[model samples]
Target: MSPTPSPESMLPLLVDYIVAWVLICTILFLGAQRLKAKIQFYAMQSLGLSVLLGAIGLAHQNTKALILAVVAAIGKCIIIPLILRYVKRRVPMNKGVESYVAIPTTMLMGGGMIMAAHYLTNHLFYNQSHLFNEMLSTGMALVFIGMLVMMVRKKAFTQILGLYVVDNGIFCLTMATVFEMPMIIEMGILFELLLGVLVMGILVQRIHDSFQAVTLDELEQLKG
Candidate 1:
């Protein structure tokens, strides 16, 4: 006789999890209306990712996942974004609205890139019993898209937010597994992110002083 289905076989929970994934994806693709809105969206995406990670952790009953869920939700999702908001108020970048690639065009291209990623990387060489294994691939795609945004965008501040998005995508995948990335390793990643953003701010100021504009196209002289 066939065995009784495990509680994990519940269809509603699977539906909810997929819905969470879709909701986070939507947040990532949402349009940025202003610098403040952009910060808010970044924060929202981080928060949503934390919750999703935590929910997945609870489903899997992994203690390490629980720890990651708490720390990430508080440290990154809550604290970093508040600091970014304050920084945003100080800098007040209007350049984010003036992306070099027009908004609609960027959105269309971003969607296409996501489709291409699925086509290229969705092929599995082994069994997919572990949920983290699936997340690793999608998380890599999300990180790639975030980097593409940073590369294509002209505004320094927008790129900073993309940096956070990329960081979160990779970090989420890291947390999904039992592998505990050492405390030093985590701190080093944080240090790099902070240093990179600080350098970006300095560069933005120099750009403003030199060109009276923030668009990177103004640095055309730097290229051969």
Candidate 2:
């Protein structure tokens, strides 16, 4: 008879799978051509992170990770997306997302970056815990792809979303390295991210309202 799988033995697999889902969501966000689709993918990606954190907390009996998971769900999964949707409604923007590079090319670049991230993480962290390696690799890939999206997308709103992606990447890195991080620091980081997004949303809306344009190319007219 086959032996039953213990939770201790299964935890790493679960964490790796969730990390993979988070990375996949970022890739989907890269190719999403509609603002709504992009927001949805970002939310899904954040949710995956939240779930991973929660699972880790439950498995290890870590209250801090559990609290952070709830905070992430409230902030990243719900509040952030609502703020984005509200901004979308308030701003007059095109339904189709515009990018300097083609979707297929962007996706290929994202894939290459993911491979590079895995390679670097494996070489540098071969002796680390599996969870650490998975999170670190996904974190680096998220950062790389987020920067790529920011550079290639034309709209200011899209750029802000890319920044959020970068924020998620940083959070993943924190999770991998700072497993015992304090709650105060975690809450502060979440608060800062929320505030930054709120400020950027207002700034972008004002820029669009005054200039009647949201794309980076259009906003370049501000150069004096």
Tens digit of per-residue lDDT, candidate 2, span 96-134: 889999998999999999999999999998998888889
Model 2 clash pairs? none
Model 1 error, position 78 (Å): 1.4
Global lDDT of model 2: 0.84
Q: What is the C-alpha RMSD of each candidate to the true structure, in Å?
A: 8.3, 6.2
The lDDT of model 1 is: 0.61
Number of clashes in every candidate structure? 0, 0
The segments of candidate 1 whose C-alpha lies over 4 angstroms from its true place after superposition are 1-6, 10-30, 124-126, 179-224
lDDT of 1 by residue, 83-154 (tens): 666656556456345567777776676676556655554565245444544556555656776886787777
Every model's TM-score: 0.70, 0.86
Worst ten-residue run, lDDT, model 1? 125-134
Error of 1 at 159 (Å): 0.8
